[model samples]
Target: MSVLAAVVRELGSEPVVEEFADPAPEDAADVVAAALNPVDVAVLNGQIPFRRLAPPFVAGLEGVARLRDGRHRYFFAPEPPFGSFAESVPLAGAEMTAAVPAGLDPVVAAALGVSGLAAHLSLTATGGLVAGEDVLILGADGQVGRVAVQLARAFGAGRVIGVVRDGDSRRVPLALGADAAVSSTDVDGLAERLRAEAPDGVDLILDLVWGPVVGPSLAVARQNARVVQVGNSGGPDATLNAPSFRNRGVRFLPHSNFLFSPEDRAAGFEELAARAARGEVEVEVERVPLAGAPEAHRRLVAGAAKRKLVLTTTSGTD
Candidate 1:
């Protein structure tokens, strides 16, 4: 059998299809890719200069594609966790598996894995989240941020405060399990107002924004609170006061290593996907056929029109 892998052979590039000797099913059965990850985006963004690491390598970073022979189909990133892309890649089946729940289409279920990984780790592992805790999810309209709203609630967060700029109530944290939701433009002194609602201060902060938006709000964290930094959506540069952290005994956890450990990735995806299969985890997709991959890539580079862009071979427009 021939394996279909996307290879990125150069710097400032995109993945091109390459064939590999599909190993005997008895050897190892792991195949599926979800989408380009933040590191892939970083490489694409030239943050660390992916080309400097290795030349003529596989460029597709993360995905939840499929694995045959009784394996779980998922959206997973390849491991090492970090790659220069590669000449030969062993797509980890664990990171790729996502449970296909009833009432949820495969594409949407496929879409949930990567987003769910980020949401799960932040709320459980790093945030040390517990039942009845209140959370402040900055830039909550983002892919992972939006899902963080739901997972936090499902994990038993008492209230979720989401910050977003999208029109319509799509960013509503309440619907996603937040007791209340707020728009970023909802009047002045937003953090103070939020503080008023939770007098003791918020327990966990899932921040997609890292700059001016969240710097000041660092004060809103309770003593021994956890602030999980998942995205640089607000720009990478920020002014952080040593006193604020020292005073609060706050903890900061980096969010980009979701694919770092396959064991952890497997456990995380399995749990999240089970929820997806049950209709608790949801994904909204703007699907494009395989032939449209090039155009879709262009749209992504130009700036995505919607949060999730899923390429699909099947049509289940339910």
Candidate 2:
């Protein structure tokens, strides 16, 4: 059967949806819903280190799919060029796939594939965050940041502060679980503002924005504070002074799904699904049809999407 997929034919080019041959059960699996994530855009733009991918390659990293036997699962990091941003995609190995619990929203499950996993692992595994510790999430208005805020609260953070671009986006993080929200646009006084919100000094920081926010946040971090660099949407470079961090013994952890074992990935998905089932984890998503994937790609690349964007196939995932 023919399938529709978003193809990236050139480096740094916007993906265009086109027809492609469908993969059989032995070859791959069928995607029911796919999410437009920053990794997909980064890979298409040649930011990732995949040297094997050539032109006209499928571009996506995660999706919700159904096995030939009709079992629903969340698929992660399908070997690139045969990614998840399609009406159908190659099945990932059993190690990278997880059964989706009944009653969880398929689109939300697709959106949470990598982002939610990263958040959960960052706090519990890397940060070693303890209940009652003050937690701050930079770029808290973004998809991963939103999940991190909620997860931080669920993990028992005493105070959760979300840093957004402005006051308009503050409500998103607050509603999710943040005790307070601050705007990154508070240029000259950003550090002061954060210090005020976190008078005890932040114990752990989930930093999605690495540019200006990170450096200032580092200055106010408490002794032994752990910082997880999850995303670099603001900019890749972050300034750090050796003497400053040395005094506090602050640690920087770069969290990625690649660091996880297949078993680890599956368990993370299961826990996230369970949280969603209990109404603890919820994703605010913008549903776009599979045919509109090209436009969705365009908007996501331009940072136009205010909410997580999930591509829905004809099977009613929307």
On lDDT, the leading prediction is 2
List lDDT for all candidates, in order.
0.61, 0.82
User: Which digits, one per residue and each the tens of the lDDT, describe model 1 over residues 45-117?
Assistant: 3466423335444444444333454344553444432221222235443234344434445556556656667
Candidate 2 residue-wise lDDT, 152-245, digit = tens: 8888888899999887999999899799999988756888898888888888989999987788887668999888988887789877778777
The TM-scores, one per candidate, come to 0.76, 0.92
Off by over 4 Å in 2: 25-28, 92-95
